[model samples]
Target: MLRVAIQVKELISSNVTSALDSMSSSAKMLHQLQREIEEAIIALEGERTKTERNLKRLKATLTQNEMREADWGDKAKAAMDHDREDLARQALMAREDCREAIASGKDDIAKAKADLKEIDEAVKELEAKREETREQAKAQSAADADKSGCSDAGASTAEKRLNRVSQMEKRTEFATEDTASARTNASVDREIDEMRRASTVDAELAALKGGAKKAPAKRARKKA
Candidate 1:
């Protein structure tokens, strides 16, 4: 029974940890989703702008085509008035081409409008989801922060360890400086001692020379 209880407790703990992890991951996903949605909206808006421009151009071209058809109609009437049936037939045939162009332009306009509407609807849906995800991510973040005191605790431990390492480095540097100072002092003392010994030897040599010269003078006087 005790073993079974221990196993159950471990399982519960594992489940709790897993749930927290899942929540954290979900929060991260929300951030990615928001960015993706925003980018998608931007792209969609750009495409919409392009569509509007294309539609405008198409309408302008359609107007030109209609004017062309009218011009052909006038030409046909003038040719018929002059009794030129061949010229009138050619003008009518050209007008048919202009009419076809106008029809195609109208179709393009319709498609563009439909496409823009769909894009607008998609943008709205994405924006709504973006807001929803943002709120959920915020709530999840707060909850995760509360539960994961481990992060803060770990940072604190790292800070203290760094401080300790810094102190040890300082101590080592100070010890090295002190040792260098002691070595320098010892070297200076040795040099001073050597200088003193050289001075003493010179003084002894001067005294010995004086004693020898005086002894010679005394011997000469005694001989006299």
Candidate 2:
């Protein structure tokens, strides 16, 4: 009976370890996915900028072509007034070419605008999905931590103790980082003091070299 109990305990420990590992992998994957989504949104914004510039250029060209078509019609009318059929015919034909260019430019602009709209919608959807994923990952982590209960086939006492220790270690590591940050701030103040001394020394030397009046000496505090 003792041997059978030991075997069952070992099996439960193995299963618990496996489940914890799977949960860890899921958490890591979710974190990586969140980062990738942020990068994709940045890239989408860059593409949007390029597309906007292209749209602006297309619209500018379309405007120029439209003006040219109007000028061609006036030229054709003037030629006919001077009884020059050949010139009038050429002007009318050139106007058709301008019309074609304007049509093509408008079409390109329309497609680019549509692409921008679609990209905007995609960004919004992705941001929403990323937020949802963040919430889900948080809930899953909490649930995994909460699901520790009395099951005869569940994790053994040793396994639960190890998990608790692991969590405590993580919290302790965060505390260590806070201590390190405090040390960094103290060092920064020392560095600032050194900078002030160095600057005063440099200013004194510069004054002597330039034949300027010497700065007043700072009086040391007397012990009262």
User: Judged by TM-score, which candidate is best?
Assistant: 1
TM-scores of the candidates are 0.54, 0.51
Taking every candidate in turn, the Cα RMSD to the unseen true structure, in Å, is 46.8, 29.6
Q: What lDDT would each prediction earn against the true structure? A: 0.61, 0.59
Q: Residues 91-130, candidate 1: write the lDDT tens digits.
A: 7667767876888889999988887787677667667755
lDDT of 2 at 65: 99
Deviating ranges (above 4 Å) for candidate 1: 1-25, 149-224
Candidate 2 Cα deviation (angstroms), residue 102: 1.3
**Model 1 clashing residue pairs (backbone):** none
Model 2 clash pairs? Answer: none
Q: How many backbone clashes does candidate 2 have?
A: 0
